[model samples]
Target: MKILRKERGGHMLDSKLIRNNPESVKKGLKVRQGDSSLVDKFLAVDEEWRKVTIEVEELQAKRNKVSDEIAEMKKNKQDASRIITQMKEVSARIKELTDKQKESETAAQKIALEMPNLPHLSVPEGMDSRDNREVRTHGKKPSFKFQPKAHDELGRNLGILNFEQAAKISGARFVVYHGLGAQLERALINFMLDLHTKEHGYQEVMTPVLVNAKSMTGTGQLPKFEEDLFATRDDNFYLIPTAEVSVTNLHADEILEGEKLPVKYACYSPCFRREAGSYGKDVKGIIRQHQFNKVELVKFVQPDKSYDELEKLTKDAESVLQKLGLAYRVVELSTGDLGFSSAKTYDIEVWFPSENQYREISSCSNFESFQARRAGIRFRSNPKAKPEFIHTLNGSGLAVGRTFAAILENFQLEDGSVEIPKVLQPYLGGQKKLEA
Candidate 1:
């Protein structure tokens, strides 16, 4: 069996890959608009660490040989103090080299952790959301006779959403769903969870919303995007930005049976984010709230089946909108717009009538082995086969709050009442509409 090397706090890319093909790694980073110089820094530190490691090994070998000679001299009752004194100097030099080796190794690993995952070859080459390619659009946008109202305005008029009260309690980017609004949010969560588990072959899991720092680092949320997360004062725990953080980390530092190659999980959790650097954008409603609800879909699969699994995962997300008869489109994210941990991604953007455009409701991504390597999640084909990192994929089966907002906007009537989607009506005790 081959020994699989593990690193502290995990790593995004294989160190051997970066060391042997530095140019290829740099090229990949350039495609993602990342700093290619990081690869150079890691290589330099790695080389220094390797040199120091060799020096330490050589010194240890010399020390061992001299120790044997000194023992033999003592057995024969001859003086061995001179060689013993030299060995002390050699031991001190070995300690110095060993410390240097550990430092360089740590520096190299830190650089590796900072580097983003390379974009997939299939990802479109361009910058930002404008460069994204639209794959398909679904459902027809609802036509309203009167001017369609924004979700916030509609909710406020119906007395179901209270942003002012929420603001007083928790500051901006928060909402208090009252009466039917609260029920609607709860209904959406149950609806999404049921649809995924019963129809999409996903096992439902309720994971912790508060995770440790190691859990965050395992899922690629640490060391780079820490500012975007809401952490406790001591920084030992963080409120989950999405269930993906807690759910994906479930198999961390563990190996699974290969026969269970595609492990799928659907988790519903309250997500929290600081929404850093977006103070001016989408501040009007729950569209970009600091806290929201989501049903996240996560998968662990064989590498060969990951892309196919990505497509399936995306459709599972789209199914939510389709079932609700919501208008949406699937857009392939460009390399520059790809996420830090994703190799390829497709965003499910739902039409918002008031905005007169589409807003992303979910992002379905295939991380290849990038996250798996970092989380130490692996699988073996057979007991005799070597373990390999499994590919990881996740998406919002549907962001519950966004789905709630979409319904409010798309189903709003001229009379200020909101019609419930036929599919969700059962969840609300056969109620067909929400009126003031």
Candidate 2:
């Protein structure tokens, strides 16, 4: 049995297409604003690797024939010294070819992993987020009667957040939640989990906060994106960059019945990232954090229904902001701004009154079998049918820290207090407002 397929965590891209029709793959990458030169390099290395495989097979065939000759010679009580030497020489040649094959395979694998998923046909062409097309806006942007303070300033005035203390203990991009700040964070988590499980037909999951390298790779966060993750000091495991890493890998290497076609999960986990590339961007306040809380939505479904499912997932995330009385807009990501594994994406940005512009709080994406192909997650349509890779999708139900910041800035009262959204009042035990 061919138990191991190089497809599993070797790299998410389709090796066959890359090796046979690299030009098409190059065009797709270019559409996604990715450097297509990797395809050229991968094709060259893969060709050499295949050549080595052929040479190794020929040597093995010669060795096998010689082995039979040596056995027959022994049976005939004839000389075997010359044949034995030939066998040894063939063996040495095979070893050398095998080593060369390994080197070429490594080079190809690196390029494959770096290649991003192809953009869906419907995606708009663009160069970056600047060119993203806004689909629709929900809720009206709150117009303040008086000058409004930013979330961080309001948080400090309310005595519910301490940035200096957080920096002292951890470093920049960290915040110490004080009193109501801690309670508010907790309340938001419970509220989101309840809404997803009760109303959205999703099962709640508490996934691990840390995961192995393959788990990261399954969700398209490894090899190319390793520098953006935080690793444990004593282990190879990385801090879960997002709950999607743990939740999506839940069915890795598993084959499910067709009845389980649409498996949905709502997971909560602490997300950690090194934020490696953003040197001076969003450096102030809790807008960007080294550590944050997120409620994630993950789905594994039949291939044909994936786009439809993506629409619903995006709505599910939007519901969070609606329930909190926040204004938001959904923007469809163009090819250039799409994530590594996503064939299509929609980013939901919440309105921050102080900033007078919407800020992203959720990103819903449909990976269209890219992740399942890497994770080896498949489903059989029936007993007589072969298993096929299922489509994988995930999104932030809402990033809690960003949401928390939104509430502070949007719900700020003239008296320097923050009112809790009505949906979360029950979770907060009838607490309606937070004050000093």
Highest-scoring model, lDDT: 1
lDDT of 1: 0.92
* TM-score top scorer: 1
Q: Model 1 compared with the native: what TM-score?
A: 0.94
Which segments of candidate 1 are over 4 A away from where they belong? 1-9, 61-86
lDDT (0 to 1) per candidate: 0.92, 0.89
lDDT score, candidate 2:
0.89
